[model samples]
Target: MSSSSPHLWSPVRWAENGSVRLAFDQLTEQRDGEPLLLATGLGVNRLWVPDGLCRMLAAQGFAVARYDQRDGGESTHLPPTTTRNPITALFAKRGEAYTAEDMADDAAAVMDALEWHSAHLLGISLGGAVAQRVALRHPDRVRTLTSMAAVPGDATGLRTMRYIRLRTLAKFARLKFPDTPEGAVAAGIAASRLLASPNRPLDEQAVREAAERNVDSGVHDQQAQSRQIGAQWHGPPISAIARPTLVLHGEDDPLIKPGAGKAIASRVRGARLVLLPGVGHELPERAWHAVTTEIREHATSAHHPPAPPAR
Candidate 1:
């Protein structure tokens, strides 16, 4: 229950319909007597949330937990690469692929495994997609929902061709480089360069530190990340969500454009959208206060007590 550092709560092996055993890294901490579950984005392990966010949320008296998605971090990898096109893999055909619904089911399964009937859900990027699906499909399992830097399955709201080309290039670079230290360094630089705001002073040490942490977290299967992305891209629409939702996006996001967030807000009735200027794709320290504040406020507001008799 301590907030000083991440504590290994337990390991969960969730069996899906196909008997696929998905592994997850579950970190739990108590805050304000409520439990908060964080589902991370693609290509990242449980460490996707920065330490500052962990401490801040824990300080707010909510128990926080984060897990690695299937095919990423320490979870089970799919198989050796066969497809050369990342975009094609992301938009896979029917029965032969996984979808965001599967990922959302995985999250719900994790919560059920932990015996939590409901928990606040927070997701970033691809993780946000899963969270949305979860809230939509299993509204009773989510007390509150927050999607950061995410889209609502609207391909038109994505970045321009130039940015897509840049991301494709980065994907190729990652495929070529894999998990080498040099590749990690290069990937970190590329991510920072692509996601950082020009007005804000860049912190080289922090970037390097983040890179090191990503590397040291252990090797990830590139194929799994690819598959997860593919599934999310072809997942269900976001119009089914009924949970009180909050969508946070940077006004200057270079990767997933702000239009995506706006689209999501428009689809989900009563979903609040908070757009911060000068922020980028990655969750920088400067935007931490606002991001966490909004999440806490939204979640707290949604946690309503039983209504008294009509008067």
Candidate 2:
């Protein structure tokens, strides 16, 4: 899938449910020796997963599809933004909240729009949270699960105060500076600086390029992003996920600590956790091979069935 190609391989339109519209781009080649469905992390349009990751996955023989979560990209953004504080909107009390389960439904709706009965699931960061809920809610719809730089909802991990404060600041920044290019650049830089492990510095040029791509792709919707974040923050339990799962985390990840991955793996039955030393929150080209390898292996093992008895 070239950058020049459309954001979605197919036209952007509403699903039968009428609440969510999906836009997706499909890879030209199939890797992992079969077709696979790919979803991007939160606050990202389709361009977040660079060509390197797409090409690598394609080489593995899995057809990759990347789409914008509702309210993030070209997909439909929720309407009638209230004058409520962004923080309050996200952490709504009780009945007023939208959970990760809703986002999972949106994902499944995307798969159904593409007419796929099931897909190999991959999600990064917030997308990982959404994917976790999807597998738990619709286990039969997932062939395998790959969660990269993500944490489960168990809350046993080392939730660093620095990371939490940074996230809160980032949200406020986005709400205040949703339009300025310089604001976008500053936000990305701040993110890189805060989330980057001191041991593994992200490439400055690469971060700049990614920021530019995000800026060029489209405007950020503060309300929608806030709502999604709130839903995940108040998400339900993850004990229901039964699919074969592989949890990947960067040891130096400052945003969601590696401990979160370990906790997630412990709670989910038979889940495998892989900690990548010296890596951070973002999935750069250096980490693509390892990430794709784990995904391919897990997805393959997930689909393989028991052998028949010798007659």
Candidate 3:
């Protein structure tokens, strides 16, 4: 594949796990960089992880790689079912597709493809929830964990609802965009606007080109989103996430409240929580420095333990 502006991604690669094929790509070369895998929100492709953010992480000695989860982007799309409403499927008694454990394995499969024995994990929104499950299910595969704008993996149904803002949830139903490529960009911007911090002006240009390239992202496909969210997590709870964990949430997040981050930080022993003032579900340019710095410091601390106290 050819290179593009803002997003300096390498050639797209395919990683397969049984019937599912995941699409992934790496940032610029960093031979000695630490392995960092990023995961995005519901029904989003790897492109959802902002190019600037990935570049900054890469510049900070992290070999970054992002992939599309099953049923999103260029990855495998499972068969549709009667489940259409994401909210209903979220609290359903049984999964209509696969278990959350399967999604966790999907992340591992990508790591295997990249030849990484283990890597640091960063996830946002629904991706953050998946990352938590990944940490719980494959503890040995995760070195450090960062979950942003997400609820606890173990929380389901009413428990999960406690952290969600219903007013913002209702807004998703009202968003309508055209069926063209331009429409895709518009929809992406609209969603970002909904999740962006009101304190900062929404920069549509920041994500327009990337969204254009990732037009195939099934963001509007509620059926696929239902299957993804409906997949139940029967694995260990967040308490079992023993990796060095960092929980971050936007103080002004319109969709998932900051309490979700608090829940994760509280349940995971020694987890550090950072609440970003005027930040929201979407990572705005203003937050780039703070977010990357926190991750860099957290990862560094994880790898290099504090010197033993001198007597």
The lDDT leader among the candidates is 3
Error (Å) of candidate 3 at residue 43 is: 0.8
Candidate 1 C-alpha lDDT tens digits along 206-292: 777667656522223345565766663344467767889999988877677788788889988889999988897777777878888
- Cα lDDT tens digits, model 2, 40-124, are 6656676666777877887776877777777667777665345234445434443133556677888788778667788888888
Per-model TM against the reference: 0.82, 0.81, 0.93
Worst 10 residues of 2 by lDDT: 154-163
| Per-residue lDDT value at 5 in model 3 | 49
Candidate 1 differs from the real structure by a C-alpha RMSD in angstroms, to one decimal, of 4.6
Cα lDDT for residue 148, candidate 2: 77
- Candidate 1 lands at a TM-score of 0.82
How many residue pairs clash (N, CA or C atoms closer than 3 angstroms) in each of the candidate models, in the order given? 6, 11, 0
Higher-ranked by lDDT: 1 or 3: 3
Please identify model 3 stretches exceeding 4 Å from their true place. 1-7, 177-179, 204-217, 307-311
Q: Show pairs that collide, candidate 1.
A: 31-61, 31-62, 31-63, 32-61, 32-62, 90-230
Deviation of model 2 at 260, angstroms = 0.9
Poorest 10 consecutive residues of model 3 by lDDT? Answer: 1-10
